[model samples]
Target: MIDDSRTRVLARPFPPRRCQALFALVAIAFLAAPAAAAVHPGQAELVREVARDTGKDPAALDALLDRAQKQQSILDAIGRPAEAKPWSAYRPIFLTEQRIDDGIDFYRAHRALLEQVGRRYGVEPAYIVAILGVETSYGRVTGRYKVLDALVTLAFYYPPRAAFFREQLKTLLELPADHLAGPLDTLTGSYAGAQGWGQFMPSSIRDFGVDADGDGRIDLQGSLPDILSSVANYFARHGWQAGGPVAARAQPDAAARPIEAKDARPQWPLEQLEAWGYAPLQPFNPGEPAGLQTLAGANGPEYWFTFGNFYVITRYNRSPLYAMAVHQLAQAIEAGAGPADPAP
Candidate 1:
């Protein structure tokens, strides 16, 4: 799955505007800014709004404001341009022998939990492992950026999607103490505020988040149970179908021409797409719904009939590249290392 386990869960937030990750820590800068200037355009107002929404005393918001302001620089530093290179370059950075080795090791270590989560969530362990592989290399590389700083920077300073980040900040503030697990421990992830092995943002951490360990709290960092469970919960919530095929190889029709995927929501239907020569090796149940997804390959082109489950994977990350990477990575993990338990 593309994991919104990075993008999908985080999607509930408002769309991004156009803020880029700056190298410096904006959190420190926000606090150090001259006492006179308003560091964020609507920060104070936002705090008040949060207070009104959550019924928390406005005074309690001071800490939140301080935290948000202090972390602005961190968000600015997230999503480094250096890290945004083309997939040809980015793919090699992650699809390494070490990653493959680590994927094997991760699968071996969490065999039981992976299987259990898979069974309960109706998602395949391979897909989950692939997500971990692509997102953080089996948790070996879950970003060093402090989540608070990243979220706040994107929320307040990043104009393109400040509203979305603001919502994440609000979610972070409203997280129950049970899920908080103390502030310092939860402060790390991708530049966009995704956290844990699955790189879930705060709101996702709250809504689709699951307490895998059954400790009565979901702690993405410390507990594998919680992390795996949270991932499974994310897929389930996004409409993952147990035992359903995620993708299928297809040959396009003579008239089938490459078309760009829509920028907004996906509403295209499979039956209509058949006119374009998108036929699969195995006939899917006609009753099932599907979509058209064409991809560029190393040589020429690749096409697949994406189903609802495949679309659910995209919720983790919007890019078809991201979804494909996860799908391929999961396949690799399955080939390189066997599952921890007998297939259910």
Candidate 2:
């Protein structure tokens, strides 16, 4: 999940004639600028590729690119994602009492739908709620950036992941016209171009979004059923084993090797980890794959035996901290605590 503070712009409605005059001036300014002055280097190639893929006219695609502005803030935010923070820092941000309470309310409000979807998709209700809670705070903060602007800015201006964002941009462009809420350019989402309660990227939405209410449309922004079911569906598709363990607390052996780089995926058998001087507080299948993760806690270090389900959670976001936050938050909400209550 990409997190950033929202920005609000207030504008008084303009008279029709004044609006027309303002638009005319802006159009003139754009026309007078040299093409290179507005278009990012390689943007033309992106436009051509999108046009070829989507059967859109290249000039029209170029014009759309011309309208997209480079957002330095997006670049800045992407540079230091929450995953980069230490576990002690990142956990508190998402595991706050307020978020946990909000998650409970969200779950209670949509209990039936969540249960139905969870049963159908073989995912737990708490996990579904936790994913939404972490991603957008139960839709309270779905972001404020126009998705077109964010995608274009990253697709052209951010070289590190330009190819990936460009593909996302292409996916956005190819969305079925009827699947969207409004004009493509006006759609708003996170700086990373993740949309709706689940904060799904364009490709994810296309692959997993469902019309759960059967209203002949999939509206993630306004439809709780669609949003909840879509999240469950994503987990199911990503190989979330039904009724499986997610994680367990572990005591490190005196000779336990210190964890360096933590891999979210379960890569070693429980037997192997046991041999390495780490043991789970709860028994798990000895043959099952597992990974050891060490987190920097306020006191010192915290270790966890992450299971396959934990890896599935990481597929949503590749951070062990993120999965832990979601797991812990889900547990807290399941305990029926309010924001004022301490986590379980």
Candidate 3:
């Protein structure tokens, strides 16, 4: 759970986006960007937008923007996403033995709560644990940047996703108290400005966050029930299938049709992929909906059949590598945790 009891909340501006930890901070030649030393020219426009959408005082909202700093580190980090790595490299990062073991331990430690939430949401307990495991290392390292600073920097300074981050910033401000991880200024997670154990952005918190503790608020960082249930709700709402296959290794022969790496959304039947020469190592219903993914593995080219549930995992962070990592980690945790235990 996120312990923000000692966190000092500061005022920050509002707008929109979704976030998860998808990058590592890397040194960049252009790290010396100017700080948002004063209110950005766009801050006024943002304030107007927020005020119009949230009914907050314009002067108060503008004051929050004044406090939000533009951090150069965020710029550097966003410029170098870990998704740029091949699957062989990315897999090792999240699928480490230590991470898998840690996921199992987390599930066992919170078995009753995790299982209870799983039953309530029709999501597997292990999947919930896997998401927390991958997103923030079982809540051990959410991030270091103040969310306000990260979003402010990205929204005003970064051009590529400025429009998206600007909207995220506004959504953060407009979020109800119940949807926040903690005090506005104290919120922090990932270079992308996500918050809490699951690394959710403002819009995710608003739309998908769950008030699991019956405390009238959703605190993803400090409340395991909130974090676990929120993650499960996100999957369920996005069409997660209970007890369905997640992913499997596939064997593509020399005569296999060449396929390009693209979006992991399932678009073909198993029959189509079979005709294309991609065969799963594990038998699957030939009529099953599946997506084909090709990745560079240590042993050479690796093929995978990702089901609807796997695609749902990608909705959280849209990388096939990320989804596969979560699926494998969840499987490992399920095996380690043994049979399901009754909720205490």
Best by lDDT: 3
- The 10 consecutive residues of candidate 2 with the worst lDDT sum are 2-11
> What is the per-residue lDDT of model 2 for residues 36-140, given as tens digits with 9 covering 90 to 100?
643767777777777787888887777777888889999999999999988889988999988988988887777777778989999988999999889999898
Candidate 3 similarity to native, TM-score? 0.87
Q: Higher TM-score: candidate 1 or 2?
A: 2
Q: After superposition, how far is residue 171 of candidate 3 from its true place, in Å?
A: 0.4
Which is superior by lDDT, 1 or 2?
A: 2
Worst 10 residues of 3 by lDDT: 17-26
Q: Each candidate's lDDT (Cα)?
A: 0.73, 0.85, 0.87
TM-scores of the models, in the given order? 0.78, 0.85, 0.87
Clash tally for model 2:
0
lDDT of 2: 0.85
**Tens-place lDDT digits, model 1, residues 1-344:** 55456667666654344222332446667777876534456667877877888887766665555654345446446546433555565567667777777887788787777888899989988888888888887777888777776776787778777788889878887777777545733477777878888898888888887876778878887788888888888899998888886767778878876656672134455556665567667876764566666555565567777777777888987766677677767777878776346567
Candidate order by TM-score, decreasing, is: 3, 2, 1
lDDT of 3 by residue, 41-127 (tens): 588788888899889998888777788888888999988888888988998999988998898889889988998999999999999
Q: Model 1: runs farther than 4 Å from truth?
A: 1-39, 67-90, 184-186, 263-272, 339-344
**lDDT (C-alpha) at residue 342 in model 2:** 45
lDDT comparison, 1 vs 3, better candidate: 3
